[model samples]
Target: MCSGDAATVPGGHADRPARPQPHGSLLNPLHLLYLACFLSQSVFLSAQFALLLYALQLPLSPTMAGLLISLGGLGPALIAVNIGKFIDRRGARSPMLVALAAQLAGAALPALSQSLPVLFLSSFISGTAFIVFRIASQQTVGRLGDGSTRAKHFGHLGLVYSVATVAVPLAAGYAIDHAGFAATFLGNALLALLPLVAIASSIIAIPGPAASAASGGRGNSAFALLRDPALRRLMVATVIINGAWDVFMFLAPVYGSQLQWPASRIGTLTGSFAAGAMFVRAIVSLLTARFTSWQILVMALALAGACFALMPAFVTLPLLLAIAFLGGMGMGVALPVTMALIFETAPVDRAGEVIGLRTLINNVSQASIPLLAGAVGALIGLAPVFWGLATAMLGMSWSSRAYWRSHRRKGQSPGGTP
Candidate 1:
């Protein structure tokens, strides 16, 4: 049996799946992998938009609409860790295909019927499948290279998702407006097919699970991975970052609606966030070349916190978009860097599980943070909610001070992957 070491990175070199050498063109392994990721993410987000529009068109109650929509996140929160473990044992391919297929089926469901139960089931299926595809994609990418290259890969990956974030919603909105809800949902399903075709084409070889993954014992527990101090800190940081993001996404539209802003203006505000994120991800490799991942992450948190603190003061569309853009840049840096660090920190054999844990944390934050923020916003105000999260973000940044300090003092060089 191949030992777990088969997947480990040592001395800045990684063990990757065997694949053909690129022919010095754009259509290489990494690009193909990115294509698959882009297709999957597009389908997920577009389907989500279609679902919300369909629910509202159904004249569902606001409470019912929220509940139905949130089931997608709930599905991932409940099963992400388990999915990770399965990936660790059997490999990403089987799980990825299954998840993508489920995504396809889920997207197609709304096309068949506008029934409440069908929408609920579709929401959960699409959410769960999207998370699985994402986790699998991350795990696959993590194994593609060593530390520095992995950082670059993740930056590119982040860019792909950001592009999808900005573009997909607009497309989905247009599609829903013209094609109608069922047709839009069906289109999402059709879009999901590209990823499956990409995978089947074998342009990128996703690594199989290490043999040792199947021989897991005490050390393999997903929670046990947190025993590594670095990992624990990273997890805490991820929770804060993801929670802040979820809250902003939730709070922004509500605030805009309350102010009677048009959908186009609200879209601009959110689109600016994605634009900022996209801009930063495009240049993150240069940033990483001069700074360690931890440094970038800490700065990102502080910057985002500052943005949040400044948010409540701004009411104009241009100003709000600017603040949102800056906040997005801050968060944009933190996210991919966090993913790179987690993969670098975890045991190679348990990479998927570690990714799965992060996914679980993110999904949980996505599901619950908005609800809590909504409740708190209703009780107090959006301003306090923004300020409260700002404080939390700043606190999280301060908590990480000791980590980067100690690591730097121990002779970790600038630009070294954490």
Candidate 2:
């Protein structure tokens, strides 16, 4: 899995000069790579959403549509750890290229065939490729700099991603409504090619592990990483915050449906949330400069909880949009901060693996939370789902406070603190 050209200095090479790290410039190729990663991911997600709707139109049963949609995560969840190990052993470049190719093929499959089997296969391939692409991009950003510089880069990364998250789905939905599903899928496949080209053109400049660091040194196992108190707390916080997002997306539509809101109004509610997220992410670096990641994360969770708790009571469109926007800001602000903390605290050699582990947790949450929300909604009502998530967010905020206090009491500097 290793690369021949990869910088790998043997042990006792103290005299060997360190390889030059990128200057964390906004215009660097690494940033370009980040943009490509964001676009690829956005396209994949939008297409997946579109695909589900398309599948429903194919006269498939609701259960069958759900199955087709969930199939995308199945392959990635199984092999994420191995994918991380491969990136750690070799480098992100090879895998990034491979993921792009897989994305192209995955998008092509659904466009070319309307059969259920082909769609299932497309989801599997696309899901696996998405994880690989994410791991590579995250690893590169983690390695691009340290401290504030790293935080700034990650802020920019999250901002682009948030923007794409809001815009791409709307665009895809428009295309689907106007041009039809086949054309939309075909366009997505073509869009995947732009990133593939970008990556191929900038292959020489993609940031990766240094020679000495990539020299086959042993590192902590994934379980061992989990055992670290700080990382464990980070993981829990990540799961909770990310899980809330899943719950919100699923529940918002259900809530709207129950209230007899039009589909366009429901879309606006969700879009408002994304708009809030995009707003905070745009200014994340400034916020990080003044507050530690832990502080920001805790406060964001608390605010998000309050917003969620209030969400069930709002029935008017403007009022609902306002609550969703505030809640979006709460949820949006935590994402990059959490990610920055994970990278800041991770073992250098194991960053890829740790990120893979995080992705694994996120994928599991995305798959399971909706089903959990649905069951809970059926048993009690949709309001309880929002209330339950509000409770979880408040709980995680408390735990985050405890985690930071514990670290400080032990005289440990978690870094990125103001």
Candidate 3:
């Protein structure tokens, strides 16, 4: 068994020096690579969304534009787990290199040919690349450190993406407003080079499996992880909370449009949410030290649900922004904790597969939830959408309580529970 003070041994060995802990400096090559990868992802997403807006300006139908934009998500949902399997068998380096190449091609394609077919093709390729990059990066990060160090790195990773989520869009919008869409796409394509160079230079440093043993026999698959009752509860909670986040993103703009809120105000409201997330992520290490993952997940979900439920009741921008901030805090706190829990609980050899499965679940939810919410909004009105999400979160809080009780019965400490 792995101890807090001892390093985890490979091949089920109880006695061995643990891998070197990650350095604290942001200048470390691995940390730089992490930053670059996240920045690239942010740029890619911003550019892709900008592409849709540009498509609309090109007189493409809104439906066609949406289809083009959604193609990015489609590829990942289909192949994320397979890519994870490849990472498990081979290593992160090759898949990361491949993903970068695809990202380059995807960004360049649309810049070179502004046609509908090229746009569609680029979206699919880029989307697939994005997922591949994410899985590889996440697996690599997981391998970089142990215990608290692992948790810290994952927290930083989440923060980078959170910041990127806010910054990239604003930057992309500015680029489109000034330099135009093609320039923005070309810039993103060029930005992809930074991570490529970083990964290439540091390829030798990327961690590999300590041993060649797989998690279990061939019958033990990614889906099998879901069979663990505790893990299942965590996964369900993650799915519901994340699904609510997607709904909020979708409904926020739609709701703003209905209320005739200015674009600037709507943007600020959304940005507030990101700000809240960043704030919580900034302090997640300290928070994790104090609270159990179960407690964090339950509290964040319940609070975020209350925030969502309150959203429809307000018309003033300040109240809305406050709600957004609170909601963001809830999600922000839950994300890293859930991620840490997954890493803590997953079998060592199957880390890549399990993370990929998590990605697959998240991708599926993101893709499907918004569509379903939109449909429900059309039938009953948008207020119910937020209400429904709120109710789901409130319900998940009880599940969390059950999990907490079960853990206590097993004599597990808050920090000790996987």
Candidate 4:
């Protein structure tokens, strides 16, 4: 994963060193990163929703529709690590532009022709592009500051994503109902152009590969990072926490249906979850200021576990909504805190690779959790699924005692310095 003194390939091109970033530059790279991510996220999420609806309208089998959706994650899961290495070598801007272009083409494909193969390809391309953009942006932002500032930036990014999660599907549904599939898809393709242009205009100054050698020594392989006990613990916690999130997403609809709740009620319930996440992220800095990142994360997991344990016991809308909201708050805090910990713990030079590993973990859970939960829930009932996830989350929180304790013994913050 390490390169020896990577030549100063600034902006992913030219032999010259990167220009010194002006301290008082009107446009901060962090702001540009957020803007680009918001736009890219909008296009990617809306495309998936629009495509799924279109597939159903075209009378495609549910299986085929699901496959089309699945393809989106499949492509990214396979190449995320390689893309990370590529970003480490070249720079974020160039690879980001390429990814956005691929996403644009992906969106435009179904507009040109709605053939089954074309639809699948479009999903894969758009999905892969979105993930690549995400990893690059995360890497860039992680590099932008030291501990506290970096944590704050990630909190803001989490808030941005929460806003998108709440808004995009509703917008896409409205667009599909009014404009039709081709137009919606084409509109997303057009939307992709905004971020593409923004990044291309050099609104964000991505550091070149020459920055990689500042950390000193040959970097370890991405997989080899697991040898570090702290990182390994973090990765394990990531899977459990992310799996809990995915499992709730899978269970919510089915659980609602079992209670005979209407579609509007279900939608509101999910909206409440998003609202809770947004609320937590909005105040994350205040939380981080008082409590260390690990302390917050472990407490959040405990809260989520308690919420899950209570979910199956209630059938009332208000009660269920409260539980979902609480769970969402827990996850919301956990997500950004996890990012801060990873960035703080990883070698500066290997941040991208570690992020890629985290992405890979998330993708795997996204693809597998539903299948596992469905089969197990069918056989054992949904209560166990809820309780099972609860046990896992609570177990993770309890297990983290050693990590935080070790840090306390050394008088080091569990997330490293700051």
Estimate the TM-score of every prediction.
Answer: 0.87, 0.86, 0.89, 0.90
Error of 4 at 389 (Å): 1.4
Q: How much lDDT does each candidate structure score?
A: 0.80, 0.77, 0.76, 0.79
Which residue pairs in model 4 clash with each other?
none
lDDT digits (tens) for residues 1-418 of candidate 3: 3325354443221112125654676676457767766866875687587778878988999788888887888656677777877787777887888888888888888778898888888888888888888888888776765555555567788888877877787888898899988888888888777777777887435665535423332337679877766567667777887898888888898889889999998888887887888998898878768766667778888889899889999989999999999999998877776776676666566667777888889878888999999999999999999999998988888777776777678766333233
On a 0 to 100 scale, what is the lDDT of residue 414 in model 1?
22
lDDT of 1: 0.80
lDDT of 4 at 188: 87
Task: Give the C-alpha lDDT of model 2.
Answer: 0.77
lDDT of 1 by residue, 214-325 (tens): 5662355688877777788888888888888888887889989988999999878887887888899999879988876777888888999999999989889988988999
lDDT leader = 1
Model 4: lowest-lDDT 10 consecutive positions: 8-17
Could you tell which candidate, 2 or 3, scores higher by lDDT?
Answer: 2
Pairs clashing in candidate 2? 7-211
